[model samples]
Target: MKIPFLGGRQALLDPTLVAPMSTAARPELTGGRRIGVLVQHGFTGNPASMRPWAQDLAERGYAVEMPLLPGHGTRWQDLNKVTWDDWVATVEGALDKLVAENDAVVAVGLSMGGALCLRLAADHGDDLAGIVVVNAAVDTLRKDVKLLPVLKHAVPAMPGIANDIKKPGADEHGYPMTPLRAAASMFAGYAELRRDLPRITIPVLFFRSAEDHVVDISSSRAINAGLSSKDFEERVLEDSYHVATLDHDAPRIFAESAEFIERVTREQQG
Candidate 1:
C-alpha cells in the first residue's frame, strides 16, 4: 500500500504542488509595476494551501511565490528531514528574489510564515513595501490552548489519531501526520520573534479570525499594540477557521493585500 504524494488532501492532486526551490527565469510581472507578494504556507501545508490566494493576487497584478516548505509537499518523514531554520531560510530567499526583480516587495504569510514575515519586517525594514498577516501565529500560548491542552500533543505529534476530532477540517489537508519535533520548533521560533515585534515598523495589515480554533486571536491586538509602524491596520474575519487563507475569507484577504501593494507602490512612486 504505497501512499500517494498528496494523500487525498484538500486539493485534487494536480501539478503535484509546484515547489519554489529554483527562482529561475520567471516571466516579467504584468498588471502592475515590480510588486511581489510572497506567500508562506502553514507548518504541515504545501504550496497548494496558498494557491487560491496567490492566484487571486496574481490576477490583480502582483508576482507571487507560494513556496513549498523544505520538508513539506512530501511525507511526514521528510518534514523531520528539515528544521525550523531551513523553513525560515526558504521564505527569506523567496522574498529576496521578489525584491530583486520588483522595486517594491510586500509579503503575506499564514501561520509560521506570518512569523517569518514579521521578523523580516523588523530586520529588513528598508526593503519591504508592507506586510499582511492572516492568522499570524505570533503567540502560541492562547487561552484555548490552555482549555484544550490535549490537542497540542495529540494533533501534530500523533496526527490522524489525536487531530481535531471536533473539526475534520484539519485532517483534510492530510498534513504531516507526525512531526512532534518540528511542532516544538515552530513555537520556539514564534516566541523568539514575539519579543521582537516592536522592531517591525513597516506598514502592516493583520487578519484575525474571530472564530479561530488554533492560533491565539489576541495576537492581532498584540501585533497592533507592539509594532512601531504608525500605518498598521487589523481586520477580523467573522466566519472562518484557523487557516483563513484557505477558508472563507480568502478573497477578502487577496483584495486587501492587493490594496496594500497598490498603496505602497504608489507611495514608493510618489
Candidate 2:
C-alpha cells in the first residue's frame, strides 16, 4: 500500500521516514547498565520527537529506547487502521528490550506515550522500577472537541491530523487523516490506565504545560491526584504548549526525566 503524506503538504515517500528502527534509536545493552527507559510518542508523532530526550538520558549514562509505535511515523492512515493492542505491543517490546539489558528499568512517555508507560507500570504491579509521564492524556477534552459526540457515533469520518514544531530540514508530507474509532480506542486505553492510576505504586513524575492546547489540564491534575504512588511529583512547564517534548520547555523534560531516572536507579521510591 502507498504511504501517507508526512507534513508540509507533499506526497513524499522516503524510506528514511518509516524504515525499521535506526541503530541509534535502540539503547546499548552493555553489561553496566543502570536505568532502562522506554520512551513512547504521542498520537500522530513518530519517535523523532522523543529522540532528544532519549539522547539526554543516554548522555547521563542511562539506557533509553524510543520505540516507534506500529502504524506511526509514515502514515496517519496506517495509524487509523491499528488497534490499541498493536500500539501497546510495540511499547511492550521496547520496554522488554530495555529491562532485559539493564539492572533497573523505568518507563517514560510523553502525551499518549505517558499513558502507555502508566499502563505498563500498573500491569507489572511492583515489578517495575518506576514510570514517569510528561503531559499525559488522562482525560482529553480539547477546546476543539466540541460537538464531536455526534460525529463520533453518527458517521465516522477519518479525522485530520495536527502538528507542532518539527526538526529542521525535516521532510514534508501531509498528515494522514485520523479515524474516529482509532481515537476512541486510544482514549479507551488511557481511560483504562487512568482507572488503575490509584493502583500504580511505582514512582511517577507528571509534567504539564500551562499553555498546552493539545492535552487537557484537568487530565494532568487527575493523573497527579489519582495515582496510588505517593512518590509522584508534578511539574508545570510555563513556556511551552502541548508538545512540550519538542517545545522550548524541552530542557525541563530532560532535567526531570534525568532526576526520575536517578531516583529509580537509586531505589528512592519510598
Candidate 3:
C-alpha cells in the first residue's frame, strides 16, 4: 500500500523511514566484541516509545537498532492494510543485520514488541544472547479479544490503548485509533508465539507493571509458565502502566536491562 507523504512522494512500504515523533536509533561504535541490541516498540506504536531504552544501551557502548514496524507510526487507517507478516519481516531483517555485526545480540521489546522479541528468541534460540521485555503480552484477559474474527469485519477500528502511561505528561507517540484488522493480526501473532514459547531457551528478562490497563497481568503469568528459558527473571514496575518503557519506572527498566545485558553477554563470552 502506498502512503502519500509531503512533497507528493509516496512511502514505499519502507519500515525504516523515521516517522514524526519517532526516531530510529543507530548502533554506536564501541570497541571489542561489540554487543548489539534490537529494540522494538509495541503495536500501534512507533520507535518513540522504545527510543529511550535504545539510547540507554547505546550510551553504555552497546550497538542498538530500532526499526519502525510496517503500518505503524503512520496514519492509523493504513494499519488495516497490513498483516502480522509485515511486522515480523521488519524486525527479522533488523535482527539479521545486528547479528552479522555484533558478537552477541539481545532482543528487547514492549507489549506486542515483546511478543515479537519472543518470536525471535524462538526462531534464533542459542544464536541470541538474551531477551528483555516490558509489559509483554502473549495472552490477554480482554474478553472482546476472543471475538476479533467477527468484530474485525464489522468494526473497522476501536479506541486505542496508546499512551497508557501514568506519568502526567508523557506520550508514547502511538496511534489514536486501533484498526481492528491490524489488531486481529496482532492477536494471531500472539497465539503463534504462545504455541512456540517452549522453543525459547535463552536468558529472558521481563518487566511487568503492577497496574496495566491495556494488557492484564495474566499475560505475564502465561509467558513465565510457557517459556523454556533456564535463566529467566521478572521485574515488577511499581509505578507504571502498560507503557512502562515511557512511564515512571522507565529508569529502573533501563538500568536493570543494561545490567542484565552485561551479565548475559559476559557469560556468553566466557
Taking every candidate in turn, the Cα RMSD to the unseen true structure, in Å, is 5.2, 4.5, 4.9
Query: Which residue pairs come into collision in candidate 1?
Result: none
lDDT of 1 by residue, 53-82 (tens): 777777666777778777776666666567
* lDDT top scorer: 3
> What TM-score does each of the candidates earn?
0.80, 0.81, 0.89
lDDT of 2 by residue, 121-157 (tens): 8787455778878778868656434444456566454
Whole-model Cα lDDT of every candidate shown, in order: 0.69, 0.68, 0.83
As for candidate 3, its clashing pairs are none
lDDT for residue 212 in candidate 3, whole number 0-100: 90
For residues 26-123, could you state the per-residue lDDT of candidate 3 as single tens digits? 33533456788889988888887887787788778887778888887767778899998898898898888887887888889999999999999999
Clash count, predicted structure 3: 0
Cα shift from native, residue 246, model 1 (Å): 2.2
Pitting candidate 1 against candidate 3, the one with the higher TM-score is 3
Clashes of each: 0, 3, 0
